[model samples]
Target: MNTSPTNSDSDTLRVLAQAIAKLILRFRFSRSRFLTLLDEELVLQAKNNDPQANNVTLSIRTGINRRYIPQLLSGEAMHSKPERLKMILEDLKWTSQKHYQSGKVPLKGSFNTFETICELRASGTLTYKAILEELMKQGKVKVAGNKVEIISNNSEQDNEHREFARNSVEKVFYTVEEIIQTEKN
Candidate 1:
């Protein structure tokens, strides 16, 4: 198989890569995290096409390690791992750990609750109530009576985040495929 990129191909690829890098930087993603996400997308692509796709083939195609491919393709991997929707959830969890001390806290308080945590974590432009509402909307937190509980353990939020990330990756892949098809035309 002869594979050589033309000048046009390289230029297009460079633009696409820079665009993706900009997104990664915007999300503050680490290199390992980006690699893991890339691995997950490749594994998902393989699985959709072939249920019995082996790790060796995936590793060869994706340039990811054979051992890593299995984990990326595992039944739990897609659902258990949080992807792009990590920031708010992570902040909430951090607050729960650092301020709550116990697993629960008052829903609205001067300290150690949604108000205080949000105050500390949220930017000056955003208020604590807004963040609390977002968390509740995302199902990452529950408010009962005067208390708010953060689902700190590996919870439904992670699944939602992973699902969102997978959908996003699928969209990007679809767009890239469309570009390739257009280039061929």
Candidate 2:
């Protein structure tokens, strides 16, 4: 039995690593933090496979310090900003239902308005500009002369934008599945 990984295995690993790197960068995860989380996941898998497995075994297998394993396992990581952005968009959509007039809303006001809706959706965690930027980037909203028009709810109306959104969501799902499968082993 050949113990070494084949070329196909190496290529697959490289692609997986690239995907993980993108996720880490997009989510602003620090390398050390990701490594710690990975170590914790490895420990969990080890324990699942063999109930007698301990931190020392995990450290030996994952090359992470045994001292840090428990801390890593106990700490809860924050949810991804993109997921939060989706929630914010949903909140914006709900708020827009009441305020939308002729498919557009004035971007001026402190209450019950488009600007206020964005702020309320952000809940102070994201700046108004940041929220608008994300919405505009996704082609979900368009700004023109002090009016923000609802171009498409979640970019459903525009085929190009819809495809982009679909690809993005698919990437998130793929990454999640990959992580789960990795942990299972």
Candidate 3:
């Protein structure tokens, strides 16, 4: 009759749940979105064991309802912020190089300036303004009267920070390599 998780198992689950909870809160991710992504990931894992995995099998393995599986996996996967920031910097670097004398791009544009770069590089779920604001807040960019200037690569410390962010993004989004391989095949 005693079917609850054992003390050690419960503690382990609690620690993992707590860490995930903190990550969600720190990143301002919605609870429902997180749940959906968790379900999608579980379903993916289930498929690894049984290639012909179905909703019922996924639900049983993941302990999530079969009904929610479809809806949860319908949305696109999210790319982490550090990855987007790195991309923005890359695009900005190009723009800076193209306009070497100025070293800045116009902040305003419908499809040509920083806006277009953000749209192409960052997640569509994020607004154009939100991405720009985050970059500005991180001191990776500065705003002029009508342009945004990248504030990087002038010193060793800035390069170190960029390297650190690149590494963090690669670690957190390592699954991207798997997704790419699957898509290719």
Could you estimate the TM-score for every candidate? 0.43, 0.44, 0.45
Which residue runs of candidate 3 sit more than 4 Å off their true CA positions? Answer: 1-10, 16-82, 99-101, 154-185
Task: Point out where model 2 deviates above 4 Å.
Answer: 1-19, 23-44, 52-83, 101-103, 121-125, 153-185
The models' CA-based lDDT, in order, is 0.68, 0.68, 0.71
Question: Which residue pairs in model 3 clash with each other?
Answer: none
Which residue pairs in candidate 2 collide? none
What is the Cα-based lDDT of residue 1 in candidate 2? 61
Worst 10 residues of 3 by lDDT: 74-83
Point to the candidate with the largest lDDT.
3
Name the TM-score of candidate 3: 0.45
Output the better candidate (1/2) by TM-score. Answer: 2
- Taking the tens digit of each residue's C-alpha lDDT, what string does model 3 give over 44-142? 777778878888887877898787766545645544344566777788888777755566888878745788888888656777689889878867788
Q: Candidate 1 regions off by >4 Å? A: 4-6, 27-31, 75-177
How many Å off is the CA of 96 in candidate 3? 2.1
Model 2 steric clash total: 0
Give residue 105's lDDT in candidate 1 (0 to 100). 68
